[model samples]
Target chain A: MEEWTVKVEQSDNKKEKPDTEQLEFGRSFTDHMFVMDYSEPVGWHDARIVPYQPLTIEPSAMAFHYGQSVFEGMKAYHAQNGDIQLFRPDKNLARLNHSNDRLCIPPIDEEFVLKAIKQLVYMDKEWIPKAEGTSLYIRPFIISTEPYLGVAPSHHYKLIVILSPVGAYYKEGINPVKIAVENHYVRAVKGGTGEAKTGGNYASSLKAQEVVGKQGYSQVLWLDGVEKKYIEEVGSMNVFFKINGEVVTPALNGSILSGITRDSVIEMLKYWDIPVSERRISMEELYQAYLDGQLEEAFGTGTAAVISPIGELAWEGKKIHVNEGEIGNVAKRLYDTMSGIQYGKVEDPFGWIVKVKEAAPVK
Target chain B: MEEWTVKVEQSDNKKEKPDTEQLEFGRSFTDHMFVMDYSEPVGWHDARIVPYQPLTIEPSAMAFHYGQSVFEGMKAYHAQNGDIQLFRPDKNLARLNHSNDRLCIPPIDEEFVLKAIKQLVYMDKEWIPKAEGTSLYIRPFIISTEPYLGVAPSHHYKLIVILSPVGAYYKEGINPVKIAVENHYVRAVKGGTGEAKTGGNYASSLKAQEVVGKQGYSQVLWLDGVEKKYIEEVGSMNVFFKINGEVVTPALNGSILSGITRDSVIEMLKYWDIPVSERRISMEELYQAYLDGQLEEAFGTGTAAVISPIGELAWEGKKIHVNEGEIGNVAKRLYDTMSGIQYGKVEDPFGWIVKVKEAAPVK
Candidate 1:
């Protein structure tokens, strides 16, 4: 692997950190950020860590007009033992490449970018919240920066990594939320950019999310675009249902995002000797299971909310309560174990955590 | 209707005009642009015509991350008698609002934005190329500018209008191009953002275009995302077929883009007393018509290439030639009439031309 050097320019004036208790998701950011440029001749070069600020880009930049952008979400935990750690950073970087392939973007050296991210997080170590369930959310994204209006892949690109300290998803506890099954709007189709963490997939989903959000639904459960029958995803997360003591999730189809947290949950379940199968499970089957009282649990997995339990599903003007509209044992255990492992309070049986070395304070 | 005011800022230094014959599509921008801001309390405000330049936007802007952006494409022609005219500008603006609806973007006043565009185009009137088939391409786009990462609609937005001097899509005469039927890599599903002139739909199409481009095909004929049977679009344009004397196009099924040029063609056909209909036309049906020697012509209609004739189609290892692999009479006549009306050489019976009053040169 080629060794990549990232030049650091520390900001002289540091902004005051936000109160950990009042930290909002993606609202506040650290003082510094990592950036890299990609062009035709230079594949990916000019890596630097500079003061977080606005980007001077052309109004006709392809990313703004064509939506040729992809992003990944992860977190840095301020461990109980004063060590900063990353949960499955490698997995996130690998998935970034997968998204790049699907979005027609040039790939980056995963190991080098990971090193740059670790260095950026270390320099902003003080910004990491120490409160319970508080962590620094890391968002790594790529945008096509070519100042052209033609509809094609961009020649120039910008890869950016920014950090934000966020409070726990559920301030009270591991509570379940209601989800509305979407029938009119579709998130993705099999041959589309659904599996890729591209901007368009998320953009296409905002309308449906907005519509359901008005009806007191926390999120939307998307069905397959082709059939509108087979289950696809719940909001932006991978969804799973525990029916008759067996866990089932939609397979890693082309239209479904291959979520890191979803993979971790599957691994953990396998470790616990829980029977889990990945296949095409239709909404009709799930509804039948609910009718038969075999639907024990339903949950979603993602980086932000590790395990979001679905308490109620409203489909076609009918509502069905899962596990009496409460978090099931499987969901509770998964959330606790995932958060525990992330915060270094549990044994690292899977070696998923990558410890960050302390860096000298920026002057 | 409330009349909107537009503030103007001229550029201190004027850029040298590109050679009319050497002008490229969307590569060289005009001297000035129109911009407007949208926020919660202030709807769409700060409407201004400013010097064309780069935008200093936050790296975490919602448009770059979520693709919540929509745009419109039209042209300002340097007419035969020295008048600048826009063809169906109102239709383009109306469609822009329709796209805004699907992408969850706040709507802009069509009349106000159209007035702003005319003024901006007049201010930079000298940039419009006088060469045959050349014109100033006007791009009006709205981007989500809120600096947040959470998945939702943006609270802040910037609607911008930029102009570029584009050479003729066909440097030579209106010639036909070969197209490949895409069996994989769906463009947009019926329930997806296919109908919206948004960034994601274009972004999702690059891979398919690239693959077909490598095989010496000009564009890909996209099938319906649900069935992959019915024709949806040809490249980014709405497609049409001439079968045994009748012109047929896919109906405005939620997934197919409602193109202004497509509308114009249908109108032109009706005015010329030719049979025209909007209905779902499957690839198999087209092939059967070709087998029966009834498929006379195939063409695509859009703002870029007002009429793009498809000479041949390659599908599943089989190839079919249309009109003996030549441009058909219907496509030729439509192109001539449309471009003629646009350039003010032909009579505008439909009152589609909006003439721009001359503005004082930038001082």
Candidate 2:
């Protein structure tokens, strides 16, 4: 690996890390940050990990209006032996570039970003939450900053990595979340930036999410745009269901994001001798299986909450309870196994863990 | 309308407005800008028109990532007898607020925004091109500036209005453009941010536009996400076509922007005693109309370019040429009439033109 010097500006106020329970999702931050800029004339340059501070950017930055920004969400976990570990960060690096490509921003070498992130994590190791379900969340993003006022791709960009110490995702306990079937709105489409974790997809989803929030639903299950018939995803997570005792998730359609945790759950479920298949599992099929007593589980997977089981699915003026509002058997098994491996409580079999080294004194 | 404290800053090194024919789109700016900031606790404040300078923004601003931004594009034309005029700027202000409401950003008082824009345009009256086919382009935008990394709305926003002296949109000539019917890529889906003039909708359309450019096409004729059959608007312009002496365009679907120029053209066509209808236009239906030789004219409407006629349509493994690669009659008439009203050369029958006031010293 190419080693880069991390020029640090230590904060004058040496505040200790707060208790894990007191941490908010995105409010608290790690000490240091990583940043690199890309210009048409000059490629990516000025790689640094400095004290986290407000960025002095121009107001006309293209990302502000054109939405020419892409980001990845991944976490570092606290292990039993006081070590920090990352789960398949390579996947996130690849996805970031893929998003950059989709958004027309200049691409960055994935390895370079990964190195920058690993350095920040190591320097801010003390900020990592030590509780059972807490970890330091790392956000890697690239934004266009070209000052020109046009609708074309920006010639300049900024690649930044920031870390925040987040509490357990579901603050109120692991109660199953209820999802409303969104027939009126759609999140992504073929040849769209949906598969790429760009900000536009999330922004476009806010209105529908707001409407569902008023109805007491936790999240939304988006349908296909044209027909409004096919199943897509659960807002920020990839959805899955167990029908006829077999695991099922919507396939890698161009519109849905290929989530990292979604992939891991499938692998873990298969490792435990459970059947798994990636296909276009329709809502009609899930509803039919639920009616026939064949549907045993329904859940969603993403980086924040590893695997969240759905307690109820409401659609078209009707509500359908799944698994009688109890956590499904497969949901629990997959969540435990994945969490165990991530937190270093289980035996390392597939070797998905990558350890971070302590910050060395100026290399 | 509430009067704002205008803080005018004069620039000593102002460049002379380039020759009307030599002006390039979005490459030149005027001497001043209008700006206001919004905070959650305090309403909008410090509304002023200052000298054009690099804006100071926080690096972690939400507009750099979540696409929490929206904008309006209009033009100030230098009419005959040296009177500066704006065409339906009130409509742009209304649309900008609509976009803000969708993105969950605080709405700008339309009258305040209009006054700010009027002050800036009037201050830079010399920048409005005097040539026949050129004008001063106005860009009014708002972006989230809160330096936080959260998924929800931002607490701080900057509302800004900037001006640019722009030449003709189609540099090659007033010739018709060739567009490709994109079968795979989807720009905006049903229930998406297509109707809003937000940054994310434009950002989502860039990749497909890139592909269209690579394939030597001027724009992408987007289709519905699910069926991939219904025709949406062109990348930034609303599309219209003449079939058997009747003008038709896509209806105001939730997934498409209701363009200002398009609305004006519909009104003008009706005023000229020509039939016009806004309805859902399908790709198959358009193709059939072209094959039957009933498609007499094809054009796109937007603020940047009043009406750009379409020469050829490439879809279904074929190229459907319109009227032997020449500008259509309706498109030319619509363009001429609109420009005439804007430039004060025609009778002001519709009363659509609004005159801007001369600048005054700030109190």
Candidate 3:
């Protein structure tokens, strides 16, 4: 793999880090960021870590007008032994490339990017809060920088990575959330951008999400865009259901995002010899299971919340309180185990963690 | 409606206007651009026309990360009699607000926005090319400026309008082009952001477009996301067909943009007492019409390419030559009438043209 040359420029005045206990998601940022530029003929070049600051882009840049942008969400954790680690960093980079392919953006060398990310994370190691459930949130994104307005793939692009100190997703840890079954708005469809980690998928979900939020729901449980029957995803996270001690999740239908956490959960369930199946679970079938008292637990998995337990599902004004509006046993166990491995407190049977290291000796 | 307070800062250095004959679309901007900002509590304010330059946005701005951006495309014509005019500016603003609503961005007052656009266009009237089939392209866009990574409605937004000198959309005059029916990629679904003029819809079409471009097609004719049978809009324009002496275009099924030019064409057809139907026309049905020798003409409508005559369609490796690969009478007539009215060469039967007035004598 071609290595990206790392050039570091430290910030003269670093902002004081926020209180870890009061840290909100994506609000406060670290002192520096990483960026790489791509143009036709020459692929990604000039990879460097510089002071985190506003970027100047032409108003006619393709990213602003065409939405040719993709991003990945992951975190860097301060492990128990003073070692900074990343949970499935390779997976995140792979997914980012998946989105880049779908968006027609140029791909980056995974190994080189991994090294850059590790070096950047190490440079801002102090930003990783030591508090429980707190970590330095890493956002690696690419936007088309070409200033042409025609609706074609851009000839120039910029890949950027910024770090933010984020607290726990939920202030009250492990609490359940209410999700409204989305029927009026569709997030994505087969042969659509649903599977890619692109900004359009998230932009398309804002309306339904806003409506559900106004209706006193925390998130919208999206169904298949075609049939509007089978479950797809929960907001930005992949969903799973434990019905009568058997776990079932909506299979990867090319319209659902392939989440890293979802894959980990499936692997962990199989490792534990738990009955887990990856197949289509229709909303009607799930409701029937709930009526039969077979539905045990439901949760969403992502890098942000890790595991967001679905307490209540509102469908057509009919509500079903999952596990009597409490966090299910499977949800708690999965969260504990996943996060435990992430924070380096538990055994890593799958070897998902990657320790951060200095890319080169400091000058 | 609140009137926007226009503050003007003239550019110290103005770029030389490109030759009208060789002017490319959206590549060269005029001297000044308009901008407005919006916050949660304080709505849109400080409307100003400043020098056209790059905009600096935070790396974590929601628009860059999650694609919370919407835009509208229109044009300002340089009339023969030293006058500049906009065709249906109100319609564009109304549609812009519609996109804003769908994307969860705060809505703008249509009347006020139209006024702002008129003032900006009037200030940059010298950029409007006077040569045949050339004009100043007006791009009005809104982007989420809130520096956060969460996927929801943004608390801050920026509304901007920029002008670019553009020549004819088709360099070879009003010639016909071929289209490939897209089945591998779907642009929009029933409950998706298809109807809105958002960036995501355009972004999602780039990959398919790139493939078809290599296949020697000018555009991709998208089908419905669910069945992939019924015709949707072209990625850039809305489509229309003449079958059995009647004009038919896809109905506003929430998955196709309600194009202003498409609306104008419908109204023009109605005014001429021509049979025009807004209904679903399946690809199979269109192919059957072609087989029966009843399919007379096919064309696309949009502001950029006012009328794009589709000369041929390639479906499943079978090609159907349309109108003997020539511009049909209906398409020629529509393009002539639309551009004629736009350039002040024909009578404006409807009050669609908004003549630009000088903006309070620039200081």
True contacts kept of each: 0.84, 0.70, 0.85
How many clashing residue pairs are found in candidate 3? 0
Clashes of 2: 2
Rate residue A225 of model 2 by lDDT: 65
* Per-residue accuracy of model 2 over A120-221 as CA lDDT, tens digit each: 888788898887789999988888887766888989888888888988876776789889999877787777778988888887887788889999998999
Q: Any runs in candidate 1 off by more than 4 Å, and if so which?
A: A1-3, A359-363, B1-3, B359-363
Tell me the lDDT of candidate 2. 0.83
Can you list each candidate's DockQ? Answer: 0.86, 0.64, 0.88
Compose the digit string of candidate 3's lDDT tens values, residues A1-363.
144478889999999999888898999899999999999787888888999999999999999999999999999999989889899999999999999999999898887888888888998998999988889999999999999998889999999999999997766767899999999999999988999999888988998988989989999999999999999999899999999999999999999999999999999999999999999989999999999999999999999999999999999878978998899988899999999998899989898999997657322
After aligning candidate 2 to the native by TM-score, how far in Å is the CA of A33 from where it should be? Answer: 1.6
Q: Proportion of native contacts in model 1?
A: 0.84
Best by DockQ: 3
TM-score to true structure, per model: 0.98, 0.94, 0.98
RMSD versus native structure for model 1: 2.1
TM, chain A, every candidate? 0.98, 0.95, 0.98
For candidate 3, the per-residue lDDT at B235 reads 59
